[model samples]
Target: MNTYTRTHLAFSMLLSIAGLSLPLGAQAADRMAGKMDTDGDGKVSAAEHAVAAKAMFERMDADKDGYVTAAEMDASHAAMKKDGQATDSPMSSADKIKAVDRDGDGKISATEHEAGSKSMFGKMDGDMDGYVTAAEMEAGHKATMGGKK
Candidate 1:
């Protein structure tokens, strides 16, 4: 299996730091939605996304200088580890885009993102239920990692 290199670290950090790289899956995207979506709606609107983005930026911009340097990111991630909130590195940007770019257009449009999520949801929803429980989440991740699709 291929692993993420150090170069991909910046991409992963940026995603976690700014919450811009919302996952293609609805569940993954909404993993933080409980804290992000102030409303009880299952979907995150543009406004809610904006608020989450601002909060992520603020968290990383600890110095409040409007600039998040590499050192700052390291510091913030270190803090996250101390708080036991840290996790493994993400797939490389190229691989991630390829996984979702079914049209092979090299660019994922809004439609493609939604479609990819739907497809993944179908594969993960083993019980054929509308919702995917935590068990299904692990199974989905494993299947995805194992190149099920």
Candidate 2:
């Protein structure tokens, strides 16, 4: 390749890696949490929450197929609802698609789940402090529930 082309390709590659570094770093940080605040720091980082979110997704997947199908979603909802643990708040299957299916292929990828987890981290980590404390979580919960805090 010509020098110009080589430089352009190199730059593009760098940008791609750079773009992924943040989220991947966040995921790594989450893995370090080893079950959310295993170190007892009195705060939860976005990475930690992302880890938890992934676990939750795995549970809802049920079939261990890495994707939560509509049938799986319904079963998950039914199980939770039957136990009165659903809070009537789980997203519908279509809503799940719109929220987490970034590829628009009607399937939620691992990357999409991680992205959703990162987004939830933003909401749960109120005050934008890069960490969530109990108070922040409570406040965020109230806000989400449309209850004044």
Candidate 3:
């Protein structure tokens, strides 16, 4: 093949790979939507939201005080590490808890967790119509990976 043809082919391949990636926030949002939609209701009512929210709250509430303080989250993180369940990279567990806590109270209440999940859901919804279509979810996932539409 000609050098020019080879270069063009390589560029095309690169573009194709790039098109398959997406942004982190968008990808996480899409994943959260799929996981949280337990009943396949297409929408997350407070009732349905409570199920996942409660689980997260329980996970973070080390003291079993019905609250998830930063301390509790830290303990949870340490346990995950002990079990080899935590990610190896430097995505600090503390940072994640801080980001999701929102109120700066050092705790992630059920309400707070639900709010965070809802915010992510809104991002994945894409069309701002309150419901996330399958296309939007896939697009968000792709965007998170920096891939093509």
Could you say which candidate leads in TM-score? Answer: 2
Model 2, span 1-149: residue lDDT tens:
56544333322221111111112233333332434664578677766666666666676788787876656666766675587433343234555444456577776666766665665567656689898665555444444434421
Per-residue lDDT tens digits for candidate 3, residues 1-149, read 56544333322221111121223245444455556577776554445444655665677677777666556655655665587443232223344445555577765566666665555455556777766644665664454334533
Q: Relative to the unseen true structure, what is the C-alpha lDDT of residue 126 in candidate 2, on a scale of 0 to 100?
A: 65
Q: Which ten residues in a row have the lowest lDDT in candidate 1?
A: 5-14
- Backbone clash count for every predicted candidate, in the order shown: 0, 0, 16
Q: After superposition, how far is residue 55 of candidate 1 from its true place, in Å?
A: 1.0
Candidate 3: which stretches are off by over 4 Å?
1-35, 40-50, 74-90, 133-149
What residue pairs clash in candidate 1, if any at all? none
Report RMSD (Å) for each prediction in the order shown: 9.6, 13.0, 13.2
> Which stretch of 10 consecutive residues in model 3 shows the poorest summed lDDT?
13-22
Candidate number that wins on lDDT, 1 or 2 = 2
Top-down lDDT ranking: 2, 3, 1
lDDT, residue 21, model 1: 37
In candidate 2, stretches whose alpha carbon ends up further than 4 angstroms from where it belongs are 1-36
The candidate, 1 or 3, that scores higher on lDDT is 3
**Candidates arranged by TM-score, highest first:** 2, 3, 1
